[model samples]
Target: MDRAQRLAYNQPTWLDTVAAWLLALLWILPLAYAVWTAFHPTEYSTRFTLLAPLTLDNFSRAWEAAPFARYFLNTALLVAMILAVQLVLATLAAYAFARYEFRGKNVAFALVLVQLMIMPDILLVENYKTMSQLGLVDTLVAIGLPYFASAFAIFLLRQTFLGIPKELDEAARVEGATAMQTLWRVYVPLARPVYTAFALVSVSFHWNNFLWPLIVTNSVKARPLTVGLQVFSSVDQGVDWSIITAATLMTSAPLLIGFLLFQRQFVQSFMRAGIK
Candidate 1:
C-alpha cells in the first residue's frame, strides 16, 4: 500500500509522455524555425551554424518592403465583417432550427449541413461567378462572401440551443417574452461558451484563409494578411527566405496572440459545446 502503490502511481508514463512531446514538437518545430529565420540575418538564415547572427534586420526589411499596416487593417475589417454577419445569421438560423417545426425544415437543415461536407473552397468558381454578377469582385466583401453563411456555425449553435431545457424557453414565454427577446436574454447568454468557441475557430480559419482571398482580391487595398504574405513571396526580384519568414510571422502573430490571450475562453467553449 506504500512503496508498491507509490511506484505504480508515480512511475513516469514514458510512452504517453514521449507521444505528447512528439506531437508538441511536430507543431512547435516549424514555428520555432520560423521565429529563428525571422530574427536571423539573411546570410545566416539558411546556414547550419547553431549561433548565427540574430537581428531585427529581417523584420525591418520585410516591413519596409510591404504595406503591412494596410494589410492588417484590411484583414481586420474583413474578419470583423464576416464574423458579424455570420453571428447574426447563424444565431437566427440555429434558433429557428432548434425551436420551430415547419414543413421542409428538416430538408432545409439537411441541405445546410451538406455545405459543411462540401468544402467551401471547392465552390470558389461558382462563388466567384456570383460575386462577378453582383459587381462585388475584388472587394473585401467579395473575399468574405463565400463564408458569410457558415453551415458549421449554424449546426454548432443549433446543437447548443437544443441542449438547453425547453422549460427555460417556456418560462421566458410565460413572462410575455417574445422569441427574439428570449433568444437574446436567455439562449445567447447560456450559449456564450459555444459562441466563444465558434468565434475562435472561425477567426482562426478566416485569418489563415488564402485561396479565396487570393482569387477575389486583386489589389493590396483589399488583400488580407494571407494574400499579403503570398504577394510578398511571389515577388519576382528574388526569393528572400529571411524576409519571407519575417513576413509570415507578422501575418500570423495577431491570431497567435489572440489565441494565447483567449485560450481559457476558447478551450472552455469547445469543452462545453462538446459536452452538450
Candidate 2:
C-alpha cells in the first residue's frame, strides 16, 4: 500500500476515542459521586459545587447512628456460613451428576436448574412460613438456610467437571481409587478457578442481599449491613444524603477492599471459568 493509504488506515477515529472516553465516564460517574457525597458534610451533598469543603463529619455521624460493627459481623458470618455449606453441597451434587449414571438423573438435574428461573425473592412467603414452622425465624441460620444448595453453583461445577477428561477417572480407577477419591484428588484441583469465581460472586450477592435478611433478622445480633444502612438512612426526618452515602460506603468497604486486594486472582478466575 502507498504511504497515503497506510497513513489513513493507521489514523484513529475521533468518534471512537470520544465514545470510549464517554463509556468509561458513564461507568465511573456513580462511584465518583458516591465517594464525593460520602466525604462532604451533610449540608453540601445536594449542592453541585465541586469545591465544597470535605469533612469526616458525615462518616462519624453515620457510625454513631447505628450498630454498624455488629451489622458487619453478621453479614460476614452469614456469607461465610452460606458459602461453606454451598461449596460442600455443590461439589457433591456436581460429582453425582457428572460421574454417576443413576436413573432419572436428567429429570432431577432439570428440577434443580428450574430453581434458577424462579427468582429467589419470589419464594419468600413460602420460605418464611417454613422457617416459622421450624421455629428458626429471626436467626442467622434462617438467613443462610435457603441458599445451602445453589443451582448455579452446581451447574458451574458440573460443567467444570465435565470439561475434565474421562481418562482421569479411568486412570484413578486403575490405581484402586473410588469415585469420591478421584473427584477429590483430580477434579477438585482442576476446578479451583470455577470455585474461586463462584465464591467471589456468591459472597458479593449474599453480602448485599437485604429482603430475606430483613424479614428473618429482627435484632442487631443477626441484622446485616443493608438493614443497618436503612436504619441509619431513615433516622432523620428528611434523609440526609451525605450521611446515607457515608453509611453506604462503610457498608461496601469490606467487599470493595476484598476485590481490590484479590483483583488479579478474581479476574483470572472469572476469565478461566469463562474459557472453560
Candidate 3:
C-alpha cells in the first residue's frame, strides 16, 4: 500500500474492537429480548431461565386482538403503489434532467435539490390540508399521494444516468431507436443496480412509515401495520408484553426475513450503485 493509504487506513486498535462489540451488543439486546418474550409465556418475560416453556399462543393472541390481516393487506398495497409511482416518475424526471437541455434547467434542478433539504415532517399540516381539500383523506391513495414524487430517487437516478457513456446513447440512436426506446433498452438496463438500491430504500421507508399514515387514515381498511400495532398496544386493550412483543415481531418479520434472504443482493446493489 502507498504511504498515505497505510497511514490513513491503519488496523483497528484494541479499544476500537471493544467499542464495536459493545455497540453491536447494544443494538441486538432489544431484539433478543423481544424474541425471547414473544416465544415464551408471559410469566417468564422478565425472568430468563433455561427451563422456560415456549409457546405460539402469544402470536395467536396478538393476531386475534386486532385486524392485523387487513393492516397487512393495506400496508402491502400502500408500499407497492408508492414504489411503483415513485419509480416511474423518478425514471422519467431523471432522464429528462440528465440528458436534455431546456430553459431554466439548472433552476429547476435546484428546486428539486431544495426538496432534499426540507424534511417531510415539516409539511405534515400543509399536506393534511391539501389531502382534506381533495377529499382523499382516510384512503390508501391519500397516504401514497404525497410520496409519489421522490426527489432522492430522481437525484440518484439522474446521477447514475449521467455517469453512463454517451457512446451507448449514440449507438442506440444509430440503430433507429427513439428516445423512449433508448431509455428503456439502454439506460434503464445499465442503471439496474441504482434502481435496485433506490427500490430497497423506498420500500423500507414506506413499510415502516407511521406518523403520516396514522394521521391520514382512521379506518382499518387504510391503516398500515405500524398504526395498527400502535392501536393494538394502546391501554384500552390492556397490557400484555408477550402479545405486544409478538405483534411487534409479526409486523417486523417481513422486513427481517426479506433482509436475511436478500442481504447479499442488497449489499451488492449499493456497492455497484455507488461505483456507477
Candidate 4:
C-alpha cells in the first residue's frame, strides 16, 4: 500500500488505541481509589498525598466489626455448590441437545435459548414464591436453587459439543462403550477448556451477586460476603470510608488474586471456547 493509504489506516488504529486506554483508566480509577483508601488512614481517604502513613488497622477493625469469616464461608459454599450442579446439568443437557434427535428437540432447545434473552432478576418474584412454597425461604438453598440450571452454561457447552467430531463419538461406541460412557470419555474430556472458562465466569458472578442473596438470606448464617459488606458499610452512625474500603478489598481479594494467578489460562480457555 502507498504511504497515504497506510497513514489512513494507522490513524484509526491510533485513535482506537487511545480510546481503549481512556476507557481502561476510567474503569480502574474507582479500584485504584479503593486500594488507596483501604491502606491509608481515614484523613487521607479524600486527600491524596504521597507521604500519608499506611496502616492495617482499618482491615483489623473491619474484620472484628463483622462476621466476615461466616460470610466468606457462605459465599464459598454457594459458589461451589452452584458451579458443581451447573457443570453436571449443563454437560448432560448440552450433550443431549448436541447429539440427540429426539422428538421436540428443536422446540426444547429453542425454549432453552429463550432463557438467554430473559433477565434472571425478572423471575425473582416467582422464584421467591416457589421458595416460600417449598419452605426454603431465607436459606442458602433458596438463594442458589433458582440459579442451579444456567441457560448460558448449557448454551456454551452445547455449542462446544456440537463442534466435536462425530468420528470420536462413533469410535467410542464402536469400542462397546455405552452412550453415557462415550459422553464421559469423549465429549466431557474434550470440553475441559470450555468448562474451565464457564466455571470462572460462574464463580465470579455468584461471588459478587448481592440483590437476590440479600433478599433471600435474613441472617448472618446464610449471608454472602456482598451482603455482609453492605451491612458493614451501612451503620446508624455514618459511613466509614477507610473501613469500608478495607472490607471491600478483603472481600474481593480472593477473586483478584485468583484472576491475577490464572489470567493466562483464563484467556486461553475463552479463546478456545470461542473458536466454535
Candidate 5:
C-alpha cells in the first residue's frame, strides 16, 4: 500500500540479476578451465595469459598415448546396444501395463515403481555376480545387460500410453489390425516424444557411467570412455595437464555436441511428454 512496499512488489531487484549471473559463472568455471587448459600448452595451463599460444599438440598427444579409438568404439557399441534393447523391451512392457488386463498387473507395476526408487549402485554386487556366472564379464554385453530393463522408461511410456484415446485402439482393432499391429501403429508413434526423452536420459547416464564399467572391464577392449579416461590419466604417468584436459574434452565431446544440437527438441519433448 505504501510507496516502498508497492515498488518492492512491482519490480525485480538488481541483486537477483547479479546472483543469477554469479551462479551461471560458477557453473561454467570448470568447463572454462578445461577449455583453457586443453587448448593451451602445458606451460600456460595454470598461468592464464591473453597471449597464450594455443596448439593442437595436446590432443595429438592424447590420441597417440592411449587406445582412444578402441574406447570410443566400445562406448558407442555399448550405448547403442543398451538403447536398442531398452526401447524394444520398454515399449512392450509399457503397452501391456497400460492396456492389458491381467492378474498381478498392479503388483507387477508396483514392483517396477519400487525399482525406480532403488539406486542401481545398490545392485552392483549382484549384477556383477550374475554377469560373472553368465561368463559375460569384461564384455560390452556385461556393461549394458543390467540396464536393459529400465524402470523409468517403462513408466514414462506407460503414462504416455495411458493418456492416448482408447477409441483409437477400438478403431484399430475393428479394422484388420492385430494387437501387435495396434501397438506398433498406434502407441509407439504417439509416444515418440516420451521415447526421445527417455533415450536422451539413458544415453547420457550410461555415457558418463564409471564405476560399473570400471569394475567389469579389465582391458581397453571392453572399457568405455569414463574408465578409459581414468586409465589415461593414471598417476604413474607424470601429470601433463594439457594432455589430460584434452583427453577429457575429447571423451565428453559427443555428449556436449549432442546436448547443444538437440537442446530445443530435448526440452520440448520433456514438456510435451510430461504427465498430464
Candidate 6:
C-alpha cells in the first residue's frame, strides 16, 4: 500500500475507544461500588482504601433480618407464572393476527398496537381497583394478573409469524395437520429464537419490577425480592451501607449470574429474532 494509505489505516480510533470505555465505566460503577461496599466493613463503605477488611457478617445479618427465602420463592413463582401466561396468550393472539382473515382484524391489531404506546404504570389505579373488586389484593395472583397479556410480546411474535413462509403452513395442512398442529410443528419451532428473546426480556423486567408489586402486595407473602430488599434497607434501626449493599447483591445475584452464564445465547437469540 502507498505510504499515505498506510498512515491513514494505522491511525488510531481513539475517540470511539475512549467513548466506549467511558460508557462501560459509568455502567459498571454502581455494581463495582456495591461489591466493594457489600464485602467490606461499614466504616469503609464511603472510603476506597485498598487494605479495607472484608467480612461476610453483612450477608449473614441481612439474610437473618428478612424473609429472603420466601421472597425468593415468590419472585420465582411470579416470573414463571407471568412468562407462561404471556407466552400462551401472545402465541394464540399472534397466530390469529398472522394467519386468520376476519372482520375487524385490522382494527383489533390496531388496538393491540395502541397498547404499545401506553405505559403500564399509567393503568395502576384501574388495575388496583379491578384487583380489589376481584378480592385478589395482597396476593401474587393480583400482581401478575394485569400482565397476563403483553402487547409487546404479542406484537413481536406476530411479526415473527408473518415472516414465516406460507408454504410450510400449507404443507402441514396437506399432511392433515390441524391449525393447532401446524402452529405447534411449523410456526412454534421456527419462532424459538423470538420466544427466547422475549422470555429473557419479560423475566428481567418482572424480576426487577417494584412499583406494581409494592402497590398490590401488602405483606411478605406476595412481595418479590425487590420489595423485600427495599423493606430490609429502610429499617427502623437506620440504613447501614454494608448490610444494605450485601442485601442488594444477594437480591441481584441471580440475574447477574444468569446473564453472565447465558449471555451468548441471549445475544444470539436477539440477533436471530431481529433478523426475522
Cα-based lDDT for every prediction: 0.88, 0.89, 0.93, 0.92, 0.91, 0.93
Model 3 misplaced regions, further than 4 Å? 1-12
Error of 5 at 52 (Å): 0.9
Clashing residue pairs in candidate 4, if any? none
> Model 6: per-residue lDDT, tens digit, 121-219?
999999999999999999999999999999999999999999999999889889999999999889999999999999999999999999999999999
Error of 4 at 110 (Å): 0.5
Say which prediction, candidate 2 or candidate 5, comes out ahead on TM-score. 5
Which of the predicted structures, 2 or 4, would earn the higher TM-score when compared with the native? 4
Window of ten residues with lowest summed lDDT in model 1: 1-10
lDDT score, candidate 6: 0.93
Clashing pairs in 6: none
Clash number for every model? 0, 0, 0, 0, 0, 0
Shift of residue 205 alpha carbon in model 6, Å:
0.4
Predicted candidate 4 versus true structure: per-residue lDDT over 1-276, tens digit per residue: 665786887755566689999999998999999999999999999999899999999999999999999999999999999999999999999999999999999999999999989998998898888999999987889889988999999999999899999999889878999999999888998999999999989999999999999888789989999999886656999899999999999999999999999999999998988843
User: Looking at candidate 3, what is the lDDT of residue 93?
Assistant: 97
Measured on C-alpha atoms, candidate 5 has an lDDT of 0.91
Mark the regions of model 6 whose C-alpha exceeds 4 Å error after superposition: 1-12
What's model 1's overall lDDT?
0.88
What is candidate 3's lDDT per residue for 1-276, written digit by digit as tens? 565665589866666789999999999999999999999999999999999999999999999989999999999999999999999999999999999999999999999999999999999999999999999999999999999999999999999999999998899999999999999999999999999998899999999999999899978889999999986567775688998899999999999999999999999999988844
Give model 4's TM-score versus the native structure. 0.94
TM-score of predicted structure 3: 0.94
Better of 2 and 3 by lDDT: 3
Better of 3 and 5 by lDDT: 3
